[model samples]
Every structure is written in structure tokens, then in C-alpha cells.
Target chain A: SQTIHQWPATLVQPVGSPLSLECTVEGTSNPNLYWYRQAAGRGLQLLFYSVGIGQISSEVPQNLSASRPQDRQFILSSKKLLLSDSGFYLCAWSVPWQPQHFGDGTRLSIL
Target chain B: GIQVEQSPPDLILQEGANSTLRCNFSDSVNNLQWFHQNPWGQLINLFYIPSGTKQNGRLSATTVATERYSLLYISSSQTTDSGVYFCAPLVSGSRLTFGEGTQLTVNP
Candidate 1:
């Protein structure tokens, strides 16, 4: 069975601080990776997705960026975080013609 | 881009009650999926019924591609089933447009 892992489970960072969230998949290779965010009262929104290593697509324009360093490892990063960047960040992986599976997610709070 | 709409934005039910959730899409889609987001914020994919019916345990889902709609049925609901149900449809490529979601509260 395939599983996705995301960390840290919860994060508290100061405003204007750097941010880096990591997600990796096991039991699958070359799967598509995605990053999504859910505000306090809003639905999940797609932030970025990657088809392969070094390939990334931004769904919504924002301060966040994504990178695929390995076949199953995706990283979401920001040079300087904003107050609006606080939310629940999730990482998911899926194959072609298949349903996406998500990780536990990280609750990021900007102070 | 595709538009997704979920009906009955909020629903409340008692334990053991059966309930149905509906999802309507604005255009044709290549894939349709139902996900349950628990109160703790974990999202579990319930079904990937792009154009058919599938059931697992007390949960069943049916998607009509021709009609651009999907339905999720919960049988003998439990308090643990209290959460948000989201319907996402993939129009083209790998992006999935998500609906606002239906918040279901099952009381014991």
C-alpha cells in the first residue's frame, strides 16, 4: 500500500520567516504530487503540482513555490512568509487515471 | 477551468439515519472523486466514480457522467461521520477543481 508523509505536523513561524514543508510518497514511483491549502473557513485550494522531477505548475499565484527534488519527494517553500500564508497545508500523490491520496497535513500558524 | 457545486451546504442528522449528498458539475469531466475531511483535518478519498457506482462499508457513491453529477449515500451514519464531504472533478490535465464541500453533522 502507498502512503504519503508530511511534516512538521504543526508549525508556528514568525512573520517574514522562511518556510519549508516536505512531503514524500512510499510504495509508488513517478507519481504526480500536489500541494493544497485550506483556510480556516474555506475549502481546499490547489497551490502547486508536479509531474516529474524539476517540473512544477502553480495553480494559484501566491508567495509559495514548489519543487520536486526526487521521484517521490516534493517540497513547498517560501522565502518570506506572510500572515495570509497561515493555513492547513496538505500534500497528495496520485497516478494517471487514479484518485489522489493525502497526507496528515500541517497546521501552519504565522505569528 | 471547470465549476463544481455541492448541494445542501450543511446537513444535520441523527445516528443510524441515512443521508444522501449531491454534487453537480458545470461541465463534463474526466474524473470525479468524493473525499471526506474529518474534524481533525484528514482527507480520505471515499470514491473515484467518474461514471459509475461504488460502495465501501456504509458509504456508497454514484456518478453520472452524462448528467455531470454525483451522489454519495451514507447508511447508518455514526457520530464519527461528522465532517465535510468534498466533490472534486478533473476537467483536463491533472488539476481537480474542488467544491466548497457539504458539512455533515451526525449527532449521537
Candidate 2:
């Protein structure tokens, strides 16, 4: 069975600080990875997706960026975070024409 | 880009009741899936019905791809069923566009 792991289940960062969230998948190779954000009481918004290593696509312009450093490792980063950057971040992996599997997600709070 | 719409933004039901959630999409899609977001914020994939009907235990889903809509049916709802239900449609490539979701509250 495949599983996804996301780290720092919860995070608290001060404004303008750097941010880094990592996600990894096991039991699968060359899977499609995605980053999503969900504000309080809102639906998830796709932030970025990657098809392969070193290939990332930004769904929306914002303060965040994504990188696929390995076949199953994806990272979401920000040089300087904003208050609006606070939300629930999720990582997912999937194959073509298949349903996505999500991680536990990280609750990021910016002060 | 595709626009996905889910109806009945909010629903409240007593335990043992039945409910149906609807999702509509603009433009064609493949790999349409239904997910249940628990209060703990974990997304549980409920169904992967792209163009047909599938049933899993107390839950069932039907997707009419030609009509660009899908429906999820929950039978004998339980308190554990209380959560947000989302329908995501995969467009070109592997990007899944999600609907706003329907919040279901099953009172025990």
C-alpha cells in the first residue's frame, strides 16, 4: 500500500519568517505530487503540482513555491511568509487517471 | 480551466437519515473522485466514479460524465459521517480541481 507523510504536523511562524514543509510518498515511484492550501471554512486551493523531479507547476501566484527534489519527495517553501499565508497545507500523490491520496496535513499559524 | 460546483453548501441530518450530495463541473473531466474531510482535517477518498456508479458499504456514488455531474448518496448516516464532502475533477494532466464542498452534520 502507498502512504504519504507530511512533517511538522503543526507549525507556528512569525511574520516574514521562512517556511518549509516536506512531504514524501512510499510504495510508489514517479507519482504526481501536489500542494494545496485550505483557509478556515473554505475549500482547498491548489498551490503547486509536479510531474517529475525538478518540474513544478504553480496553480496560483502567491508567497509559496514547491520543489520536487526526488521522485517521491516534495517540499513547499517560502522565503518570507505573510499573515495571509497561514492555513492548512496538504500534500497529495497520485497517478494518471487515479484518485489522489492525501497526507495528514500541517496546520500553519502565522503571527 | 474547469469550474467545479457542489450543491447544498450545508446540510444537517439526524442519525439514520439519508442524504445526497451533488457536484457539477464545467467542461469535461476524468478521474472524478469524492472525498470526505473529517473534522480532524484528513481527506478520505470515498469514490472514484468517473462515468459510472459504484457502491461501497453504506455509501454509493454515481457520475454522469456526459452530463458533467456526479452524485454521492449516503445511506443511514451516522455521526461519523458528519464532515465536509468534496468532489474533485481531474482535467488535463494530473491536476484535480476541487469543489467548495458540502458540509454535512449528522446529529446523533
Stretches of model 2 off by over 4 angstroms after superposition:
none
Each candidate's TM vs. the true structure?
0.98, 0.98
Question: How well does candidate 1 score on lDDT at residue A87?
Answer: 99
Q: Candidate 1 at residue A89, lDDT?
A: 99
- Residue pairs whose backbone atoms clash in candidate 2: none
Top-TM-score structure, candidate number: 2
Q: Residues A8-108, candidate 1, lDDT per residue (tens digit)?
A: 99999999999999999999989999999999874889999999999999988999999998999999999999999999999999999998999999999
C-alpha displacement of B87 in model 2, angstroms?
0.4
